[model samples]
Each structure stands twice: as C-alpha cells, then as structure tokens.
Target: MKRILAVLLVMALLMSCVSLAVAEEKKSLTVWIPQYQFSKAEDAISDQDFWDGVFDKFEEENNCEVKVEIVGWGVYGDTFFTSLLNEDGPDVVYVTDNYDLVKRDLLLGLDPYLTDEQKDNYILWSTAPENAAGEKVIVPMDDGVAIGYVNTDILAEAGYDELPLEWDAFIEAGKIIQEKTGKRAFLQNWGATSGTSALMLAFWPYYFQAGGKMLDENGQISINNEAGLKTVEFLKKLFDEGIFDEDIVTESESVDKFANGEVAYIVADLNKGNTTFTPAGVNWQYVFSLKGDAGFGARTATDSFAVNKKTLERGNDELAVKALVYITSGEVMDAFHSQIFYLPPYTKDASFVKDEALYALTSAHSDAIYVVEEFEAKKSFEDTLLANIQDMFQGNLTPQEVLDETMEYYNTQLKEE
Candidate 1:
C-alpha cells in the first residue's frame, strides 16, 4: 500500500512539472490594424507579406513572435468593442480616438516609454491632452486633411479653369457646373453608413469657415451659437438650390460619383486624390480649404497607434511598446506613407515625395489646418450631430432646430455617461 501511494505522488509531480513548462512558454503578441488605405497593388507584395518581414525583424530583436490581423472598416469597430469585454483584445491596435478607452483605463500610458526628444521630433498634433491622467496615450501615425476635389475636365466644361477659394465664389462655380453639365455640383455623405469621424470631417469644416468654435470659454458645447446656425443654413441652401446632392442622405457614393464624372466636386480625405482619382484616370486637383469667416479653417486628422492595457497582464508591456515605437519611427513611416502616397508623418519625409509640386501644395496649407479635440465625449457628440444634420437635410428640422437638438442631446449624453 505504501508503494502504491509513492507511485501516485510521482505521477502527480510529473504532471505538475509539465504544466509549469507550458505556462512558461512565450506567447505570441497580437496586433490589429484596420484597412486605412491602399498600400499596394494586386501584383505587388501583399500587406501580410510586408508585415511578416517586419515582424520577423522585431521578433529577432525582442525574442518574441507577433501575430497581426488586418481588418476592414466594417468589422473593425464591432471587433474592438467586443474584444474590450473580454481578454481577446490586441496588444497594439490602431485608433482614431483613444479618449474613450482612456476613460475606461484600458490603455497603457506611453509617456514612460517615449523620450522627450522623440515626442518633439514628430508632429504629435492635438492628441496630448486626451488622457485625464496627463500621460501620453498614442503615437501619431500619419497626417490627413479634409480637402475639396474638383474634376478638372468638368471644371473646364463649366468655363472655370480653377476652383474658387472663397465660399461665395465656390457656390457660383457649383451652380454653373450644375447648369452646364447636368451633373451634381457637389456631394456630401451623411448616411448612416458613414463613420462618425467621416461625418464630422464632412460637416465641421463648414462651421469653421462660418467662424465657429466648438467650445466657449467655460469648455462647454457652444455649437448652437451663430456659427453653428450659419453652417446648417449654408448646407440647407446647397440642398435647396440643387448644388449639394439631395440624395447624399441615402447614398454614400460621393467618391464613386466623382470618379465616374457624375459629380463635379467632393470633399474627402486628401489621400483619395491618389487612391481613387489618379488611378481612375480622372483629371483632378485639390482645394485645401475655402476662406471662411475665421480666416481659413480646414479639419485635419491624425490617427494613432496605442498599446492595450491587457498587454501588461501577459508581462510583455515593454515589448509591446517597443514594437509600437519601431512601427512609428520615421524610417518605417517614410516607407509606409510612400506606398500609399499619403502625407508623411515626419516633416523631413516631405523630401521623399515623387511629386514635389503636389507635396508642397498639400504641406503649404498646414498652418490653416486644425484637428478636432479628442475629448472624452467626442464620439457621442459626433454621432448626435450627424443625426441632427441628416434631419435638417431632410427638411424635417430647421437649422436652428438641429443645433438646439444636438446640444441638448450632447448635454444629456454626457450626464448619463
């Protein structure tokens, strides 16, 4: 009986040793990236292949492997939100707004990992104050601007060689384009399918042009004021005069229309000029921003890379941050932006552009660009304002009514959240 008990104890000890070995094995860190742009052609190296080579270098340096998942926009949001409820979230992920996650304490503070010199080297833009803890939460990935695109062919047919730079002149040109070509003069996307940030990009520049500020001295929402009302009224005028496509509320095909020569102008991310227009063989040019009451107000965007707090649980927080730093380094961004023809993340990268004239034109307007503050309530405010704007476009609500309703909803949502 003693021998039997000894044999049982030995078996248990062996099992315990096996379990310990398995627990100590290095686990792969996962990364999630959304489809932000067309980085390669069908015949070119695949994104997966490019990343595999990049990760192999990282693994060699850090002594750990990485798994990357590239997701489309349609599933990116839902996948992220669902992952937040469990332990399946990525170690590093791409985010346009990290304030929401910061509020939940789900992001790792990046201040310790990044040096002061490094921070000053890149254009961090307006993301510094997004964290209540006052710690850096993101690394700016790329520079983007919401600009106007006009089909030069259509403009030539309409008797205009270049697009006007002021609001009134812009309207006059739009009317002429519609009258002469029988095509929609401009397109706006306010449909439910549009991303909230995209909706904000479509609408906020107009408010800025109307001399509006998003907040007052006390830092409360002041969007219901004169500037807000004027922006709404101007959009209403566009629909009333048949210049802005009335079908925008139901269709998110503004880019497609511009590519097919069905529309004369569109307001979209500056990258679209390369991603869609140039490839489609459409002759096009950019209008940075129309001169507005506030001197020149164009909305610019700077999405970022953030490390998830869950990475700490795996005892690989430092490794994850190192991977993030490597990806955002000037050398990597230079290569990445070159592939997509996007505005480079570093000022020095401007010299790398194939078309110096085009790059200079885009970069010259940097002073006029402003990024919307990434406040904690930004997502909610954008969603609420988008619905109200659609109602105004549908003629169910007046411009004033839209502003009033949106401000009220914003206040109530803030209180509840």
Candidate 2:
C-alpha cells in the first residue's frame, strides 16, 4: 500500500509538469503588416512562407510561437491606432512613415531596447528625431524614391536618343513623342481635384526643380513665392498642351498608361518599372529629374516602421524590440529590397543589390537620389498642397487659385491646430 501511494504521488507530479510544458508551448506572438505587401498571389504565398520561417526560427531560439496578421491598407492606420490603444494589441506593427507616426505620438521610443552598437548599424537618418522630443520611434525596413522612367526605345522612335536636361526640353520632347507616336507624352494623376499619391510623386520633383520652398524652418506652410507660382504654371502648361494624360486626375491611371505602353514617360516609384512594369515586358529606363532654372535637385519620401508604446507596456518590450531589430537588420533589408524592388536605406552601394537590372538602374541614378528630411515638418502643408495641385490639374481651380486657396486653408488649419 505504501509503495502504491508513493507511485501515485510521483505520477501526479509528472502529469503537472507535462501540463506546464503544454502551457509554455501555447505562448504566442502577433505581428501586423499592410495588405499591399501581400497583395499579389505570389507575394502572399512567399510572404507567408518567409515570415513563417522567420517566426519559426525565432520560436526555436526563444521557445515561443508567433502569429502574423496582414491588415488592409484602407483601414490599416485606424485599425493600428485603435489596436495600439487596446490592452491586447499586436506584439509588432509595420509603420509606413516615421514622421507621421512621431507627429501623432503613436510610436514608442526604441532607445531603451537597443544597444548603442546595434543602433549605430542603422542609417543615421533613421534614428534622428523628426520632433523636438528626440525620440527615435521607427526602424526603416524598406525605402523607395520617385523617379522618371522613360521608355528610351519610344523616345528614340520619337527622335531622341538622350533625355532633356531642362523643363523646356522635357516638354518639347513630350510634344515630339506625342506627335510621332500618337500616344501621350507624359502620364500624371489628375483625378478629383484632390491631390492623390500619384500627383504628389510627380509634383515634388518639379517643386524642387523650380527652387520652391514647401515649408519654413519652423514648419509653417510657405509655398506662395515666385518659384512656387512658376512651378504651378509650368505644370498647368503641361496639362494645357496635352502632354500629360487627359485622365491623369485618377490614381494609378497614369501608371496604367505607362505600363500599357500608352505613354512615353511617367513619373513613378522606381519599383513600379523595376518589378511590375518589367515583368509585364515594359522596357523602360530610369532618369533623374529634369533640372529647373534654379538647378534644384530630386527629393523623395521615406517609409519606416515604429514600435507601439502600449505594446511595450505589456511586458514583451524586449521581445518586441528584438523582432523590430530582426526586421530592419541588413540581411532582412537586403531581402526586402530584392523582393520589393525598392532602394535600400542602409546601403546605396550597387553591390548590395542582387537583381541585375535593379542594381544597374539604382546605380545609374544613385547620385540624384536625395532624402527629404523635412518631411515630418511639412506633412500637413504637403498634404494640403498635393490636394490643391490635383484640383489645379483637373481645372476645377486655376494654378494661382489653387495655391492661394491651399495657403489660406493650410494657414487656417495650422492656426486651429
């Protein structure tokens, strides 16, 4: 009887240990990414497998399971904000742009989570504060810039072997292309009298080209100068000349035109041609922005990822930071750059890119790629300006009217804020 009782007690202890082990195995993590990253069927499949492998590796090393949930772009921002404010939010979330996140106080400062050496490995601008708080909120995963992709073959057929250097030359070339090919010379986004992403992409290079200041140092809206007016008028002229697509007011229409071989040249993200257009058999070459009278250069927006402060408060801060590091590490960035066909933020070296075509394209235009650091400061005005410019393109408002109205509305909004 004594032996049997001892054996029963030992069995009970063994069962309790097994139960504890099962509970530990159930530990899980959740990560959120935008739907666009997984939009294509191939992208969806590859991303799932890639992330699964990454998570599995982490789990094997740390003894925890991970769950990745992709959220749609339309509702991603709102959903992420709401989730971050919740008690049971995701362990990690992808941030599109760091400046926007910092402005809204939606991101957690990652300084505590990283060692000095670890932080040093990242690009310098990635860690710089866009706000006065000096909080480095985001880690850049993948980055891309707006560039002019000209169909050299079409340009040559239109009677030009080299691209124009000045705005006048560019417009003239556009006319020649249109006259010769009976296709649009340029493609733009002109839909709805409200600035769309496509229009913003085209407008920035011109603004820089014209030597216009979009915002003041103190972050005040300030695009009412002569250069600004000239820039707007030039774009309006392009529209009046029929150099740009008639339906450019809509987002993706211009890109569609370029992809369909209906336009000789289009302002686009480099990835559009490198990945999407090339695979569809559209042969295009990248070029620097056409120089303006002031010889101003090109500028492009930067996208990044940030941590949620609320998530940090939930006791997995270290793990969350580790996950962020893993995502932004050079190895992961190279993979993302190759897969997404975007410029890598950490390294500008062509040797870093694995894709032959992409390497050559990026290398060719490397000297012209300029990072816009004032993006966070000018976010509000830039948003307003883009909408107003779109309206200008649609002829709902004249160039002057758009500029004046945008300035008035922006100043009013700033005062209210």
Q: Estimate each model's TM-score.
A: 0.86, 0.85
lDDT of 1 by residue, 219-258 (tens): 5657888888888887788777777666768767788888
Which candidate's lDDT is highest?
A: 1
Kindly provide the TM-score of model 2 when superposed on the true structure, using C-alpha atoms: 0.85
Candidate 1 C-alpha error for residue 155, in Å: 1.4
What tens digits encode model 2's per-residue C-alpha lDDT throughout 304-354?
666666665666667777877776776666665555445644633223554
lDDT of each: 0.74, 0.68
TM-score winner among the candidates?
A: 1
The local distance difference test score of model 2 is: 0.68
C-alpha RMSD between model 1 and the true structure: 5.1
**Candidate 2: stretches off by over 4 Å:** 5-9, 14-28, 36-44, 97-100, 124-132, 192-196, 294-296, 339-352, 356-387, 394-396
